[model samples]
Target: MTASIIEHQDLGTGTEEPVATAAPDLARPLIPNPQSSIPLSTTPQDHHIARMAAVALGLTLIENAIPTPLPGVKPGLANIVTLIVLTRYGWRVAAWVSLLRVLAGSLLFGSFLTPGFFLSLAGAVCSLVVLAFAQHLPTRWFGAVSHSIYAAFAHITGQMLVVYLWLIPHAGITYLIPIFATAALIFGTVNGLIAARFMNSKNEMLIHENNERHEIG
Candidate 1:
């Protein structure tokens, strides 16, 4: 029967032709391939950016929940993650995380396409630009804390520009700069300290791991 089946498929050859069959695993049923099923391909970096963005988004939500005296003021706790990502990965990854957080947070909070959303986007863009320059500074002196302050100031500056140009469109808006600057300094320092501490801990853990590996070797 097998010979006859092969003979039937053998057209002009007049000889038995090999039959290709998919060997199905009895224990595992077939399903759509998770890898190729996607329309666009993704890389490890994409996933890493996504996870970091999620963390920032969570921080954003937490910051939103916290009551503040000022309307546009929050701790900016998410900046801590951005600083760390900048150091560990690079500017590109950090930018992705920061921008994604702004976009996703706005959508989540039902503020998409609103003035609030524009403010968030402006701040994020400014921070990312400042970080691009800040990253070029000497790492010895201008580390996480310095970068945090620069980015924070840039963030506020962007928001203020947006307010002056689009929203308020008056000289009176300039007066609020001092208030926003103060908030930036405070939050920047706090977030920077936290990020520095976190990075220090990670470095210590890596050193310990290397020592253990040397000992094992």
Candidate 2:
């Protein structure tokens, strides 16, 4: 009778132990809850940001489609949009948008794996990095013009570096600098003026709207 009682107790203990272990395992979450998991699809702010990025990208594509007299001379018009994004949304978001623009633009232009695509990629990356750094400066000091100038220079520099290293391995690469510099100045100034005008106009409108809202409220 004593042996039987002990055996019965052992069996009960074993079953209960398995049940307890299995219960905890079942209760565990499949994925850990992260603090950064905001549902962007439903969030109003994210929706607005997405809309802005899309619009900016559209404008960039339009600007890029415009043919220049020179082969490599682009107004860097898309860069103006990127600068605005960096100023408003921060670097990480700007970087993402810039990269997407490059990939999409490459595909759209049907130059996906060409040397030109690589050149554009290098220039775009350099521009974004320069713009990101520029955003940290006081807006009053650098403003739109300086930022555009610096970004344009960086873009040209990056393209030249890629060309010299990979694309054109000739000794005549140095001669191209004068031409790129001149072109950079012209395009950079034009884009800078456009950016400044756009930024200032937007600011004015926002202020006016805020004042009207306050009066109504």
Candidate 3:
């Protein structure tokens, strides 16, 4: 392959000529062929979901750093991002973010396909199911806090079921439900407040910008 550039003869002169230069090795291929590389065909919504998922995954990493008293008990900091996505986009995008966070988080922590992964997956699915119906609730009463709380409860409930049926298979596990539920309530409310505040700030910023634009116009 050959490449050319327009070159001026003098510092002040605008007259130009094509100067040949060595081009990138097309034969070797700088970029892999689409078929060979198997790139994903994605749209704007897909990109949006991916970006949201990435943010949630970061939160997951952060949550992992925080110490927990017991196994399977997490603050679920990523769900805050999911709530934001759900209210802004809808359940589908939120579901995508939640599931992606679980999958990606497991892969990142080297726990993919493990019991922990399944537990995480079950929690995500249950939360998403609750969110699907919760989103339809009237905005007058139900908002981010309600949705988050409901989702958190659903998440813990799902995990408890998994623990009793698959992992432990003992009546003792049910006793831990209250402990998990309490944790869910506390963390869920806090997460909901944070998400609500963030969304409010974002909306106010957007409103201010729009008002300034209108003034200029």
Candidate 4:
């Protein structure tokens, strides 16, 4: 008995051959898109808000300087506005405001080219960095007193560093520590009080809260 094996293949003979599915093109990252990174100031409202904040910051600095002594020692009354802006807007905006104040204040006081300008610039830069960091700290942990102390220390540190490194290269620069520390303590206390008052004030707190909510909304 011969056994025959039958193999059958079912091939569609009437239809066109099946098209092979093409592999998908790997999706590329959308990078360097100017539309995404470029900030569009298309609205007048944005301009108005920026202008108002600028004016407020400028006026605050001038007014705060009125009561300060020794040209560099003050309660940092302008910092109140800065703190507010830091909490309200952002670090970038706060930085801009701080820079604007320094530049404008320098020009207004006619110290644009003097040592005073450099000192102020140094102090402002240090303070902004400190405040930017402080803003992220827990409010209860630092509040105003601790923030003031830190800021004062940073300010003094920046000033003294500049003086030691650039202004006075002599070894006798260390002698100024006592004087600088005293000034730091006094100004630091004053700034603490100012900051505490500003932070604790019901009206200011309410305004800040409302503004924050508005921004979020």
Q: Which candidate is the best by lDDT?
A: 1
Tens digit of lDDT per residue, candidate 1, span 71-155? Answer: 9988899999999999888898899999999999999999999999999999999999999999999988888999999999999
Which stretches in model 3 have alpha-carbon errors above 4 Å? 1-35, 203-217
My TM-score estimates for the predictions, one after another, are 0.78, 0.69, 0.78, 0.60
Name the lDDT value of residue 46 in candidate 2: 36
Ranking by lDDT: 1, 3, 2, 4
Candidate 4 lDDT tens digits, 73-170:
55555655555556555677667766777777777778786887788678778977897788778866766566666667777788877887888878
Tell me the RMSD of model 2 versus the true structure.
16.5
Please list all clashing residue pairs in model 2, or write none if there are none.
none
Clashing pairs in 3: none
Rate residue 159 of model 1 by lDDT: 94
- The TM-score between candidate 1 and the true structure equals 0.78
lDDT of all predictions: 0.84, 0.71, 0.82, 0.63
Q: How much does each candidate deviate from the true structure in C-alpha RMSD? A: 13.3, 16.5, 10.9, 21.3
In model 1, where is the ten-residue run with the lowest total lDDT? Answer: 1-10
Candidate 2 lDDT trough over 10 residues, lowest sum: 12-21
TM-score of 2: 0.69
lDDT of 2 by residue, 94-113 (tens): 77667777777788779887
Q: Least accurate stretch of 10 residues (summed lDDT) in model 3?
A: 1-10
Compared with the true structure, the alpha-carbon lDDT of candidate 3 equals: 0.82
